[model samples]
Target: MSAGASGVGGAISAHGLGGAKDLPIPSELAIAGAVAALVVSFTVLAVAWREPRYDAATSGRPAPAWLDRLVSSRALAVTARVLGMAFFLYVAAAAVFGQDSLINPFLGTFYVLLWVGIVPASLLLGPVFKAVSPARTISMAFAKVSGVPEGQGLYAYPARLGYWPAAAGLFAFVWLELVYPYSTDVGPVRLWCAAYLGIMFIGSALWGTTFLERADPFEVYSSLVAKLSIWGRRDGVLVLRSPLANLDTVVPRPGLVAVVGVLFGSTAFDSFRESTPWLQLVQSLSGSRVWPDTLALIAFSAGVALVLTIATMATGVTSDTPRRALPDLFAHSVVPIIVGYIVAHYLTYFVEYGQQTLIQLSDPFSRGDNYLGTADLQVDYWLSSHPTFLAVTKVLAVALGHVVGVVAAHDRAIKLLPPRHQLTGQLPLLAAMVCFTVGGLYLLFAA
Candidate 1:
């Protein structure tokens, strides 16, 4: 949604990723994709497995012995921690010493590398942030020095607060990204990083590392997406769960719906805010665009949560599972959709700016130092140049996500709803999912 070099800002501008974009898909193709999603929804309902298929304890097959051993080894763990700390320190140095210009690698690293890159990294590596998180490393050091048990704090983490903190943290991040006008400034972004580390450290110390799992925005987001990866565990043995099964294993926790809502909604809002109408409206206004944009962001997020809640609860539920609990319980179904949109929204930005970040990292102070041996590398714009392929890929990604979401919601419905109500109970949620998928396609087409 964001694009172009502007008068006031440089680098990845506040509104643009700065490159040629895929032409909008034809209206016919967009309609075809939406129809495909609906057709697949019913096809799954009519012929797919009726009994729930995933169980965290039994779903995946264990990996080979040697591979599992290497993966779970302490040596590998320590190496990952050291590498993580090294990367964090490298970026921290840039923030401390670099200029506030567009060339600063910190900007690309934050907005592109870390924020957008985490999705793919975690997908391949499984909870990658947890492996190398600086806050987590420091928290461990603190626990060891203070003689506290690992991952233990002053008290037990309350179960009632499940994921709420992470949801709030994620919102804060998207606000800073999408709403806060000074998002690209070095000082402001640096301060946000400092505050993030500070909060992560303090929270981990008080509540142990458990706090980070449910509160550190990056950790939570990465872990959520990791569920879609082929890597998983069965009874503490390394195993591979199919993405669908892995997705079904997600625990139904309080505030889970809000977390997914913020993720999907923020992305949709990014497209909306960049639309021509929004641009004209904001431009013609008399004041700062902050409040209008903030309200719009909030509305997008809350709107997703509202739709999910209402759709999931509209049908009759059993005595054991309240209608109110259905949203969070069914929330996992939306993860694939979120991941799909993430891929569509950030693919070009991540690949193009990612290369730029590598180039800039070699010259963190903007003084042309080739410290990382990557300063001489040039970015490949092949992906950006091939607009047709890129556009088609985006539509397919959205459609694939929609299909997975439909299957997930369907499985959960049949498993939870009474047999008589199973099919009927899924109709409302199916419609809601279709709307989301169509609207997302519309945004990409219109963007």
Candidate 2:
């Protein structure tokens, strides 16, 4: 978590949000982790499963009929939508009416739960946000009332647009959280959400739920991570597969590389901007930190995308596949790596601040009320207290994500590249993956 203004009716501080800073990960551990990532990456390239193993159309055995029926039931779908809408409205009321204070639940819901929590929730429950997305629910309701079929819109969604809208949405979010000075402020953040909801509603009206699938940042992100969960579907039947195999099922789409760039780069920028050197420089600029931070954010995001584009395209390609399409084809492999790094970056923050948020949620109005009986609960800071254990966990998570990513990319390479160039074509992507891991470790150490 990052620092901010301490109390109600005050603007956010530029330092960072949340409370209690993490001790910098030890230099030795950072090096060891980076070395391990490099070693495991090459090892996977050399000896891992070489044949193309995961196919969406044929992989994964059908799950139990009863379980599938329960999961796909109309009653269950309605229940999920109702619960999602109810929760959205509950926190939305807080955003609209509650005190502009750190104690407000709206801030927590937007920043921590919705933004950070979506990863783990989707990993565990498979596209959990999509199930409970209020945007989708409201759009469906409007369609029904207007006598239009649900998910049927005014026009066919443009395939070429792909995930670009989602990429933009993601950049907007990271900008708000990392670069925008008043991110913790109630009014600005609320306005952002209002605009998000408005755009989602209008887009869904124009392009149907396909717009949400392609444009909703949280949905796109959650769905990507869901590919790593054991849960899956084969011909609309619930099935289970190895997470790696499940991950291989992701279909390449335009702007996927951009999504990868923004997620990873913004996170790196988050750490970089908070480093002592950066803080001192920005503070001495004799101007607002907003411009510097915004520029840095753009640089980081663009840097990642550029590296990815060059790395992916700097390879042999068959005549059947355009060189330009290679980046999106390989973009799915970056999902696990991103998830792994995010866990390392935000683990303690989410666990600790998430608890704080829950306790605060019990008293959304800040009126000395404990409606949820959780107001008195205390956050356990054991993770923050044990710096070594936390550091090791972060390193392990990064390494594990790297290994999975390498294997995913390797499989895709075998499937997509010419037989003669399969091994050679993968070299650049593998190197890029190593740079991402090592650079992430360096940030964990230096920043």
Candidate 3:
């Protein structure tokens, strides 16, 4: 993805947060990935299990008692909260007092460590954000001091609001990073963070941690990706389960479709926004480009939701399951596809900038103080340097994600659709998945 530069003092590029785009993935690799996606889609449709293979109640065996105790320990919880708060305050100091330039660690932390690092952290460790979310920690502390029980809100969390707040928040973040012209400017981003923290505090005060779980974009997104990890819980005990089985445990609630739509759509929009054609068109306008970029973001996000809703609901349903409810129910199937494409889109950016952020962190105020002792370290540009290997990895990752998504959807179809219509019901959704995968590969190849 390529864009005009946005940061102060010429430190950042127009392409938003990433420094330089990897060379467009070779066309041959893109074609190979698209072909693999097609083969996996039909293969799963043909030979995959006809019966539903996962159940939260019976899928996994509990971990050993010692491990469970260690993981669930109060000390560990308290330690995590302390660390989260400390890190938040440290970054707050930077944004409040540091230089308004690229040298400021605040920009890198916000753009790189948070925006990109969350994906891999969630993939490897289940719901990593939930454990370390500063807002959640602060809200819990307030509750304790106020003599309120944890998770007890003034009113029950509205089930109908499930994940919608998070969808909005995620959209706002992408808009800030990709659409907002002064995104890298210290003041605007700091203000945005302040508003976000304020809202999270207010929302949680009203609805308890349930608000954080559902409304916090990073938490929701991380938790969604965490579903694809081997870690899970059954009957209050941690257990290891296959990714597919773990993914099946996702209890689809209202706005689940919107959440997935924003996640996938925003990533696609990131690539689309940077294309030469879009850049030329938007730049040619005499007025501000903000209007066009905002509309494109909205279109991309809403388009994904619309397509998914239609695809999932197009199927014939049993009397017990309403067609209207199918979209959210089937939303979990797209999580892998989103994760795969995100990897393709952000792999180099994350690896390179993530290291850069760490080094920058040592000199948060840009005075060249090496507080964390990482000031002398150099970012290894190996991934960016080896464009060919990076391209192949991206293609393979996308192809693998497509295969898992297809299998997950197939299992769900058998469970939800009438026996007579199960296979037929899946065709539209399968086609939608194929379109998404192919379209993603095209972005990789062309952009």
Candidate 4:
């Protein structure tokens, strides 16, 4: 057997750790944390909306001094623009030079990472990409072209509808990723990418010049951070002027990192499991039974729910109601939806393919191959040569996985966060982060 095939095969056979019927306690615990986060976010929002004073701490604040420097730094702006241009260029090159066959794995993996990981994480992190966003970079380029002002006062908060819309949009994105596998040919992929880029460009055009002045979610979050960092000062202006900040002001909570880690880790785990033949083999052997599959499916659903709930709680806790606040909307509604998309998409892959498919794909290559570099080609040809029904089934399985991810993400976001938290908003995002991070690490390395 070729070294590559041999290694893959060895990984597959080592899957005998345990049966799939068992549910890890860590997974269950993580789910509990997710639930708590949701409840807390909702409670806080409800209280704040019902009473105006709840928002007093969060409201008020000129842009921070550092923010002024950050936005106006020519060095940072140039670097961002360069990277953004590079990303688009790479995509274009891949489309032009890469063969269709070569594109599948890359596309599949890329879709998984984008929807399931990056999108959701960004939402949770509060316009995280804005600081280093390619779109932001592109926007900056457009700003230069249009002669927009570049100063601290330029970036301000605009409106608040909670975070639901962002969440919904994220859910839609995940659905697209999951459905891509089953969708007809690669035509959809091209269309999707084009659409994404177009939307980004249009949004940039609309806000590039006035992004700072506009009441956006990011501005609110930044403002809130700046406010919390201020000590012994009621005046927002003075708070911004203080250059030396304490850890408590800057690091909202130690747990927030964990929450981000777990949310992000789920996607990472999905990718690792998908790529690592050994992990798949273990999962297959343990989860092959109907009961095991059912358990896994349930856990997957629970995880999605947890993400939405957490977002709702976080938003509600942070914002005051009847304010129609922009930051609260983005932080609570938008971020969670993104996270949902990521979790749902990856979960779909797990449910549809399970571990058996991976094991089977690794089988033929275990025995020595007569053909030299043609092993992958042989495998592909063999799969194509299979009975029509079998080939179709395999393709459908792959497609279905993506679909499940999208559905779960969207449904969870739409159904869960908004209503519950509006009445009593209080979410513990930082706490959730700590729990998720610890849980994820346990799953990845210790478990």
Candidate 5:
């Protein structure tokens, strides 16, 4: 089995089925596979650089008839839609009925399991999410409300509105979820869910049938990802697709595994960082040294960025591969990234303010205090006690992580895309990294 698969299997066996003490170190075989993936990624880049038109297979007419047929099948699309919607409904219900305690161990564990197991499995099986996405269902509902043909006219828009605005709106919603997780509470969650569905139905009616036909950002992103897979074909060959497609091709699966591992692991690490007084004592010994503080902060941020980037890239790449066709890559990436950030950012609170806040809110029957009553007050208290320098360091750390993640992503893109497109995709990412680095330094020193 692949290293990614093995790591997943091991994690499942250890965490899912076995006790924490029974957890095993990642197998050596898995590490080797990860290394091999990196090697293959570089190899593809080198070859693509030398021969732009190099063909690995003699049969050079677009991918085999079977591959095209499989992707285009309407039955496959319907199945994916059903599955995606089902999963969303299940999670939504769990979140609402089970309360805060349901967020972890139950909902959280299920989410992880689906990503590692179901998502990957769908690449070979079909577009799993497409079969059952809440978003799609909402859109269909909106179509009905707006008097548009059912599922036919939901995406119509003028060129002036552009895809970016829609993309930005989606991103904004995700950011809110990440930055303010309370938005997912039972009442708010249901309201937002209904609102989204209403919007889709209205949009479809106003825009005519063409609205529903409009290309979604998620679909576009997925196509780009699918183009980068080893199974991606411009011709009947196993060669890389667009030279610009390099970002998605390199040791795709292992890269994905690493991203997920780091995200979850870092959150755990942060929890330990906050909860472990011994570690705090060790940190205190550094006495606010710029180097150690900066390093710690940067590591934290980079961990998050890496996780988000990998998850986004993976969704983009694998959406149309032999494995699966995930149409809601945008939503999937947004939800997890935002949720993870909220959890990580609040780690300190969970530790320091536990007795006063989280512990109480987590209890379903608590009557003396509520989230807004005692919990918010405790957060204010903890905030007052935290050192200004610590906050500064944390911000710097986040900036550094973004820089590292952008660079890593750029490197992958440069190696995958054609030489011409290499600079196009990579330059922006590089510029962003530079800007983040400069901003971080300024924050570190100016504060």
Candidate 6:
């Protein structure tokens, strides 16, 4: 019933590409993952360092001077921007000029490469979007022409606005992808991208690059995931930090909880909508699924934000920081969970369709051009044929994400909570994380 998959079986699918799905994982494996999550949560709480281990101001060692020079070089920055812009223009050309058939590269490039592929790309290279953001590039040119200095706008970006704009932008994109029926239609999808582009330009014009940093959904998501990468900066110098240590450096800001919620919730909803129970329910209802799916998406996102708020705020707090702030403070903990769900849900779509996209890229006009030498390339279906390996990989990814999240939350809790309440404070959050992990596992198994 959802736009992602046809009501019955057909060529249309959530991603442009679809094939045999991995069978439901064994129930025993799901149970084991849930149990492992519990064990890891408590183990970290009981035995992990009592004192706070990560301090952004003091953590991480500087990179090798040559490496730093390479990373920070103007030539490298210019090249990244040029490449990103080139790719964007190439895809935009296809979207604007190509046939509206399923084979068009735009859909896969947008939904698969840009959306799903950003995670792994940012994992290896920190904040790839921010570095190569076409909007940022254009904004910089505008500022220079207007005689404005870099990083400054007509007025300062409101501190209170924080990441809320980015959260809303993220929600908008997910709603379009997951709930809108015409998401696969090139025109609607193109319009959505154009709107996103307009917003980025206008917001940057008004609030400067700071607005883009906190308002561009892709930038915010990529930058946040980049925190889990080894690359970091201290005093404007490139340095490397452990993932845990780097994660702890995330600045708590307004609406961070909602950002994570939309991310995790939307992925969860993707799985839920594809499951048979929900599909049959939608089939029985027999109207447009737009309203139902929209409501469900809202519920899933709000539910996560609600759970996170109650879980983090349930603990006792010191006068130094209010309990209400704990949600954003601990929001970084769930970044790993988001990454996990992304891996579990989109791994096949990304790797498989990503290749297909490269192939299509060579023939952007659907003219059989093979310009990039990719049209002749064959997409390997090795993962699709190997269901067991795929299933185990999904379960393992979810468990590992939960484990990292638990440890992150534990570290943050101890650092913030009063001594008497430290251990007790984490219990509720721990329970909440377990439920999330188990729920995620169940969805992956059943979906």
Candidate that would win on lDDT = 6
Evaluation by TM-score, superior candidate among 1 and 5:
1
Error of 4 at 137 (Å): 3.0
The positional error of residue 189 in candidate 6, measured at the CA in angstroms, is: 0.8
TM-score of each: 0.95, 0.94, 0.95, 0.40, 0.40, 0.95
- Encode model 6's per-residue lDDT on 1-447: one tens digit a residue: 235323112423343223225744575667575667667667756776688888999999999999999999999999999998898898899999999866788877887788888999999998999998888998998999999898788778999999999999999999988889888788998899999989999999888999999999999999999999999999999999999899999999998999999999988888787778987888888777888788889999999999999999998899999988889999999999899888878777777767777788899999979889888988887877787788778777788888888889888888899998888899888888888987887776666
Residue lDDT tens for model 5, 1-447: 111111111222111111111112222332233334434444454455443332233313465567677666768667666777765655455445555442222223232333233323333333333334456666765556766576554344664443333343333233323223343244554455455555544654566433422323232223322332334443433332432232233223212322332333333333333234534665778654334433443455455445344333342232223212211211122222222232224323333333332333432333343432433443234432444533433333344344324433544444344556554434433443334334322322221
Q: Encode model 1's per-residue lDDT on 1-447: one tens digit a residue.
A: 342112123433332222225644584676576667677677766576677776777888888999999999999999999999999999899988999866788877887888888999998999999999999998998899999999999877788988998889889888888888777678888998899999988898888988999888899999999999999887778998898889888888888999999999999998888788987898898478889898999999999999999999999888998998999989999999998888888777777777888888999998879999999998887877777777777777888888888888888888899988888888898889888988887776676
lDDT of 2 by residue, 188-256 (tens): 989999999999999999999999999999999999999999999987889988998899888889999
For model 2 the local lDDT of residue 350 reads: 74
Candidate lDDT scores, in order, read: 0.83, 0.83, 0.82, 0.35, 0.37, 0.84
Candidate 2 error regions (>4 Å): 1-25
What TM-score does candidate 5 get on C-alpha atoms?
A: 0.40
Higher-scoring candidate on lDDT, 1 or 4? 1
- Listed per model in order, the count of residue pairs whose N, CA or C atoms clash below 3 Å is 6, 4, 4, 55, 42, 2
Query: What clash count does candidate 5 reach?
Result: 42
**Model 6's TM-score against the true structure:** 0.95
Worst 10 residues of 5 by lDDT: 1-10
lDDT of 4 by residue, 265-315 (tens): 333333233334544665768643334333343344346445534544444
Candidate 4: lDDT of 392? 31
Q: Candidate 1, which segments miss by more than 4 Å at Cα?
A: 1-21
